[model samples]
Target chain A: MTAQPDHPDAKAGHTLISVDAMGGDEGPAAVVAGCALSAQANPDIGFILHGPQEQLDPLIAKHRELAGRCDVHHATEVVTMDDKPSQVVRTGKNTSMWSAIESVRSGEAAVAVSCGNTGALMAMSMIRLRKLPGVNRPAIAVLYPSSNPQGFNVMLDVGADVRADADDLLRFALMGTSYARNGMDLQRPRVGLLNVGTEEHKGRTELKEAYDLIRAQGESTGFDFVGFVEGGDISGNRADVIVTDGFTGNVAIKTGEGTASMIGNRLREAFKYSPLSRLASLLAYTSLRRLSKKIDPRRVNGGVFLGLNGTVVKSHGSADATGISAAIKLAAQLSENKFNDKLAARVAATLPAEESPS
Target chain B: MTAQPDHPDAKAGHTLISVDAMGGDEGPAAVVAGCALSAQANPDIGFILHGPQEQLDPLIAKHRELAGRCDVHHATEVVTMDDKPSQVVRTGKNTSMWSAIESVRSGEAAVAVSCGNTGALMAMSMIRLRKLPGVNRPAIAVLYPSSNPQGFNVMLDVGADVRADADDLLRFALMGTSYARNGMDLQRPRVGLLNVGTEEHKGRTELKEAYDLIRAQGESTGFDFVGFVEGGDISGNRADVIVTDGFTGNVAIKTGEGTASMIGNRLREAFKYSPLSRLASLLAYTSLRRLSKKIDPRRVNGGVFLGLNGTVVKSHGSADATGISAAIKLAAQLSENKFNDKLAARVAATLPAEESPS
Candidate 1:
């Protein structure tokens, strides 16, 4: 999987991001629209679009700005949302998702973005890009909208693997710290180990061991280890990065998202209950719009797969043009900053030599 | 610990609840006020208030309705919020929390209610009231407000213990099912095992094992086992009872609560942003109030400890009069239905004979 060294774009100064234009619920149109939006916002970004050329060409032609910067790579197959990870690894070689990731591996693109099934995307990324040196398990880190001055906090191992030993957790912390620094611009991110209680003696035995390991690496890694934190701190300003096992982090993130949506729906229903409240809703529309913008999940739609040789951003499966644009922007930003290289260096430096898999 | 044979109210038909009034953040005054409110609402309910007599007497005397129906039990010690569970279990015999639990053990009260440190209360309850036979761990079941017709769903193992194996999770499902049935008045509650994904092969190995165990006992336990459910279903009407390990349950519940509070605060701020919005808020005040009442955490304030020999309800430490009253009402409702005995019987009948701890 090596790019053609003689290719004209190989020496191009602009950053190239691989875009999987299929597999999402919104189809190829949204992906093309999102790429056009990103190209309009950032002139130095280029795309290696992977999908059936027949379907993607018409959509790309609609936007004048994207037509010049985007290059289509024809892929015959697509990975469905219900496909198993193991199945995808074996027979998904020709799919757009696989082709998109291949571009990164072959050095044709700096990062790859997919709005597809999370399990499938993660499995394919791991199999294709492989893990960084000394990393036993890769983690998926998401940007959580919080009350922090930065407006977002990084949380990792959201659903990469359901299990994490003490050593794995330490790896997650190092990776999460690097993401927080690069993504949120925190100089010395305060990392918190998520537990049921903040006390030293709460949670499973693995978490206790992880706490000590993380604290020991804090000085060396340049990130502050803040002992333990609880679920409330995920949305609060208590920590810039919250680390936990995949199971708990995944459940917590989804629960937070669901609860937010439920409350939002309830508020809308309350405002539209009567003619008077409906009139009031019109008056309060601007303020409500401001609040909506502040808490919109679409603004932070990408989940970065850390501990890999290449960077991969997994956007929501049902992402609209705005959500896809956010993911594309994140991918471009990470590619420009060489996030994957920095993350690998951070993991190698902080992870103990003894814990590295031989 | 035994009740006095000659007590005048021993033969009374009314259900008596033991309430620890000293340790909550709001102190005994709120507890007394809550008892008065409950007494006014339910004439057949009686309370045995456990705290310092001097402090509680004046407060109880002010509420004539409570003064007639409440009996004070003097206790000298209080369990601070920071006390360790192991330490409390070993040396917290004289605390009001301990005495309240003892009342339930001695049959002087049908159920015990405490608004104190959760760890200490759980420890004291286990030591005084003991775990039910065949139960390895007792779970704390909570009522989560949902879109169901019942207005709430049951979730269990929420911070009771940080670990749960396959057997333990099966026990949690049984206990949570009993809670939904007795507490929510469901004839046969639908039980769902919480997982990161809804697929059969997803999540940790123990959760997969639990799925099989719970499904096996569905017919005998008289509950519907709905297979695996994700975190989003926790607040929805898809399941009446959601069962999970303590760690995941604890994090999900807190995350939901935090997200709800954050959004609620944002909505309030949006309404008061400008004079037009403020006037809009005034016009929509009634609908907003109705929405607030529907989602208020105070309305579902009790966390019932299941898989135990006696019933114990834990109220939030910072609960005010309305929250305390809600806890008292839950205790009375459980006592009236003889929930503890029914739960024990259900556990014994559904649990395998060989899996019973010797």
Candidate 2:
């Protein structure tokens, strides 16, 4: 957990970013290449790369931009995709995933980004960074591509924890609101509680209780409460921030992704069906590219660990260099904006638990 | 609630299908037109129409196929979309929805089809026809367009009861399997319990319990249990029938629909970007049309209420004539197969509750 002397206290204006260069579906090569992409894009950012030093050094050396900006942490062990979260926490002391979070926990890195096992990353994050004050459970917030003017919306509790009580859902609303404001640059994000229906009497008793709590916090929290929104509204323009329990949120996002993938496949098949259509595909190349870009899953890559003491962005396991770059961009933005500090202060101030004697 | 004498007991081979002619967004005109389309396509199907006599007579008269075949039931009241299920059950005795279900309950119609409030339809169906023995909860089964050979898969508990216990999910598995067999004509259908992940130790406690229960019933119940499936597998080829609690299933389906709708819109926008692209759209017209029809929501419009004494198909509230016709087609198919009888028998035989002491 000791700080690397090479980074040298972020070099005045430089932002030190920690990254796990192993455990992704793509090897340390893609991860190191991704770090180089982030390094080349911004001169203000420096990297603390965690993996086998031998495997990471060559990849980092190949990129001129990362030659002097990168620090290699020698982590011999790798926490695999199949490894259980609890198992990883106990045995993952020498793993790259643990060392990456350790940099953020030690305050040597402004943010930590990993394309590793999500469950293990979250588990390690909670243990190392700990929960923010007035937080019972942490949540994973992701940017969902939407029809909004910003072209994306914030959704929370994608899978940090499967269960969320009424109070926990209220915390997600506030956390999501903060994410939209600082993470996405929304001044006053509109928040909505995800429910089976928009009606007041619909869904479980816990959801109804959460609805009232979120609505009550609207005026004071400086965010618009859109009452209850359904699954469709997760991508709709109605709410800038969508809040739900991890179980439903996880299912909703995956369903959206699967549907998007299916439609994209069908579109390609449609274009390949006939000779003339194939030619047409060539003619409409730019337009099709534009559409694909608009709905690209990689464009909105990164699941942020919310309600934690420090910022952590969990990239997709199979993320390519581009996807990894997207996640690093998010982490840098959050670090620069000091999103975690603002979120923690907001949670402590607004949480009903702070006001009550429980 | 008496059967009209003019129909004369389904004319030996004719299937008497009841339908609510009001409450849909398009009104009674679309419903009658849809009935005409179904009646025109199928020779052995007769409709016992529900609505006001004056309002229904002209619509029925407009379609020559229903000249002597359609029997009208005078029910002045209509269940509006805003009306609650409990309110409808108490004061909706004269409503068309009630009359439509009554026809099925009174043994005059093989199946009941309604494009009204779903909650009301389910409540009325449960009260009128009642639940089959050993069935704790009813489910709404829907067909999702997928990569399967049948081009679709069955998903149940779409929005029947929001909360489903482990036993209820097991019931959903049986009912979904029955639906896949009879409705989609898939023998030895593969069933999967929907979860956040396919891993054995993921999701809620009820889900894990449901997984073991469903897997145990595979051999005896005649279903190929593929174990736990994630949201992505809802449209994947891994399983023909996906089972889950109504809350998660409802969200998953709606999210899929929303994503599909967004993709379709983006594709149109892509084609209309420029004059040359417009020409390309013209050349690719047939291929694109084929793709659209394949993913068209109307093509799989009906949501069948399972675990009831009689089958009831709940069509989309915003359905046009085409959507209504699709729902009617599904109702006819289930009626012809005697799907409700088989489902009831299946539940009585396979339910663990049937074998255990209370």
Candidate 3:
């Protein structure tokens, strides 16, 4: 097993964060608040808010301490989260998001965090940083809000690519395994192919072929191959890592998030039913508040774009200050763990470097 | 709009529930407890537990009140949930699940409920009772454990057939709309097609074609077309009815359920960290208990196999008594609403009686 390298930021005494200041629903306010909070939390961290200085000047003034740590770069345009990734990337030059991507590529920052269009971030990251040597496809590795070390199931390719073949899936399994080991700090992560059923015969024909290939190369692969895992196992924490195509993974994650939100809303509504219950809601507010904090959407908002040459975290467009702050912290932590270095090394050593997508 | 019909169960003094006793993981115990609870809660609904009497007798004796409401129909074997639907129906003679399905076919019971293999239930139900006159395919409808009127999101197939054409999806939409009107008493329930995105260019070729068909027919068909809904909307209660093929729907639901279970487990772990939280956990146990009860899996375990000529509700194989009871209630409710009658009428009016598979 290869050891992960330390981050360049830790050695420099200045933690650099590349922020797409023009991203997300609230735009500059949310991003600046996040930058301020992160800089305050870790004095060592300095944020290069990649957007227009004129638009961000007011936000930087709110946090006096962060004023010194936060500097605004002039990238005039912004990418809407709803825009088509390929179309936007082709047309969007010198945009705040694209500039942020360049920061990571130029080694101006340890990590780039964006809350803009997921597709744009992915396309730009791949184009600028390129894929790790030998990785055919770069999967967007997600850490679901989980319990055990295995609780945080890693769902690959949530949105990077949709129409993947068997070879793409196998490559995802390889990338996903390294991600689980280096990012989550799990040894020999139990890798399971996400299927409708645990039975090998179950799932799409494409999945079946991928399963066979995994089985044929099963022993030689360093991952602790756990055969097929049913959908239920995703939340069960039985498998350390789960792999699936972006189409399915995106739907699965969205479904999970929508359900949790709906349930949370229902619970709130339930508590508001009567006067006595209303009072109970106030008295038990702290407990419920704490519970909600643990499951905060902002905290779990970032998705690590794994299998890339450098580290990048994607946040939700609707994220608020808390979410933005969490994204910054997450990017910092992922960079500090030397997640990309470890991932690149693993892909290079285990598979031919030239196989990676350009 | 079609007026909702009177519930069939309401006409009879004793509502007969045909139970596939041999079905499911816990088998007799699960069915017995479910039947007992159902009978205890709704005295009008009686049960005919169809299986080997020798196997069910002990479980029957455990609840005297349920014994008064229950009877035994001796079918020595069961159709395993793992068996292929076509093979099991052809080879498994006198299987309790098959017999239970037959009971509904012959009008021996008001409704039939099973926790056995879904494929077998779909096969037996389609072969015995048949599809609604103009319905090309039968859809499995479940209450999206997330919805406001607590209205159910009707997803067809749910795993009965893997590949679906445009016509199959359209059939699912029509059947699902009728089900919402009849089952949930919604007037012109909003129908949304489950796709990767809401845009015209968002889905695959088949889905794109289905989208066009839905737009063309929705105005004349009485269903309020809400346009395309992504997986994120499934649990947001965004639309009263959601339509998708058997494969994606099954994976989506399982993903939703798995996520809920995983998050619940994570909360429990997070609360274990502190002395204050542990003490609060004990005191807030009642509130948490109430919350858990409200979101109980047992309350919504059974999924309705829609578009069939008779009422057939499939419970998860791992269903506990709560899940079984939910299935029983759904079965009873469908019988009362005459769900099949309403769906059959709608299909005959809107679509052609015989259509080729897409």
Candidate 4:
């Protein structure tokens, strides 16, 4: 029931990406629509869509560009978002997420993009692709739109594991720097260790140890080590790469998102309070639109799983076609840049033999 | 050398607050001005100002209400902002911060207010007043402006100690509940334990244990226990009191503040983008002003150090007269409500004999 690319022109110099089209909240239709949007924008991008073939084929056929590029791979199961990671690891062999990662492992695809459960995706990716040699733990690197010159800062270990020791944090720094360099095109990304305070004597004991380890590897890693940075610096231009344990990073990311949305909603209410204010909103609509675009979460919807043998981008599960397209575009860019190999080289070069994962 | 209160009427039925008028970024003049503002608002509030008499007398003289209400206590030394907690404990016996806490210790004032170094203030408060019986580590409770019916949610351990065991967290819950009851006048506040997720089986090991402990004591402690909450819930209306370890709570608070300020600055830029927007801003100026006042940090500028025998409110070091007055008002209100006695009683009642501080 596969939807094969019939046209020979679609195969010319194209890079294939495996996408899990089943588990997202928007279902296969949105996934197909997003693929169509991505294919329209990037002529050389193709997708191996993993889902129920009968369900994906009809949606894929609606868009001529997607029909010429996407090939459906029939997957029997879908990983429910509520499924435990342990449960998924034990019995999620034939799921769409697993099949999507399998495409990358089999060298049939350059990368895998998923809008599924984060825990299941990470578990399947680890078991299938395995961790890179000498990498202690894999991290989820998110591009935070910032006031930096690069327009975005790389923050890692967003939710890979709830814990990180000194060695794990150092690895995050190396991997994050590589991400900023390869993905965002920064030559020397300044790395800042996230903490409660910028003082040397503050925060947990592990943070202090991680600070020393990161400082020692700054020269070898080819990234400038800016000392400790507070939560405020995550959006500021103080650093290009912010590294923290998963718990702190995850909470901080959610906090920032919640705050932005809350402020946006309040601003809208202010503009609609009265007739004159509504008229003012009409007159200032263009500037407000520009401001909205600058902070739009859809523009940066991908979270790259670093320290893996293959690149994987996890889009928000409930993302619309615009957000999914953004994730697909990010996956395509990372694949074109050969981000995984460079990240591996960077990790192996900076991490000493003694500190390598067993 | 002390500025004696010549007016006898200032002493009648007034609540005295010991204030460290030095070591803030704005200097003693701002402190004096703030005290004057508070004095103007609350006629029954008096201050035991700790600083050099020469420097304090001139500023106190500027406001007739402040001059009549303030009694100067000459202290030869001042604790600098950069002074370590350990260093302050070792050699800061004669400093103004020490003198301010001493006033509370000697029963001359109901509570102490300081804008000095947080670590130093906490250290001095613990040493002078000591932790209440059955309380292991005292916590600093902050009032976050929220959408709750009370207009704010009480969050504890904002930057006290970075570590918290199950017992310490349980104690924080008790103290925070007491704070809301007395300080904010909530009859029965809903207490929430902050975690990375709302699920029963999420976050660190200690959080799970703390959740069970808090849940068990919900009826006895006179508050509803909302099991788990994420960072987004801090500013929401789900709970009135949010309890977490100092490290996570501190980082979360700073993260929220930073995000709000960043968005605020960007919003200002959007409104000033063009001549039309500038004109729009002019028409929508009143609504925008109301919105700004609602989120202004100054209106809620005090972080109360709970679990100590005496109450200590730490104002922002850079607080202006309005912010300082807000902090002073908080201290005065807590004194009027007998918050310290109520908090101590609450801790003594909830904590088992085995868990009591030695």
Best by DockQ: 2
Better of 1 and 2 by DockQ: 2
All DockQ scores:
0.72, 0.74, 0.40, 0.65
Q: What proportion of the true contacts does each candidate reproduce?
A: 0.67, 0.65, 0.43, 0.56
lDDT ranking from best candidate downward = 2, 1, 4, 3
TM values, all candidates: 0.96, 0.96, 0.89, 0.95
Off by over 4 Å in 4: A1-4, A7-10, A353-358, B1-4, B7-10, B355-358
What DockQ class does candidate 1 belong to? medium
lDDT string, candidate 1, B1-358, tens digits = 1223234245457789899998999989999899888988987788899988898889988997864577888999999989999999989888899889988999998899999999889888877888888799889989987777787889988988888999998989888887887888999899999998899989999888989989998877788999998888888878999999888999999888877777787889998899999998999999999988888888898999987779999998889999999999999999999898998888888765444442
The regions of model 2 sitting more than 4 angstroms off are A1-10, A352-358, B1-5, B8-10, B352-358
* Candidate chain B TM-scores, in order: 0.96, 0.96, 0.91, 0.96
- Number of the candidate with higher lDDT, 1 or 2: 2
CAPRI quality level assigned to candidate 4 from its DockQ score: medium
TM-score of chain A of 2: 0.96
lDDT scores in order: 0.87, 0.89, 0.77, 0.86
Residue-level lDDT for A303 in candidate 3? 86
Of 3 and 4, the candidate ranking higher by DockQ: 4
Residue B174's lDDT in candidate 4: 92
lDDT of 2 by residue, B1-358 (tens): 1323475354777788999999999999999999999978887788889999999998888887776678899999999989999999999999999999999998898799999999999999988888788888889999998888898989989999999999999989999999999998898999998888888987889888888888889988898999988888887899999998899888889889988987887789999999989999999999999999999988799999998888999999999888999999999999999998998889888765553221
> How well does candidate 4 score on lDDT at residue A241?
96
lDDT of 4 by residue, B187-289 (tens): 8999999877787867889889999999999978799998898888888888999999898788778778877887777778998999999999888888788
Docking class of 3: acceptable
Report how closely model 3 matches the true complex, as a DockQ value.
0.40
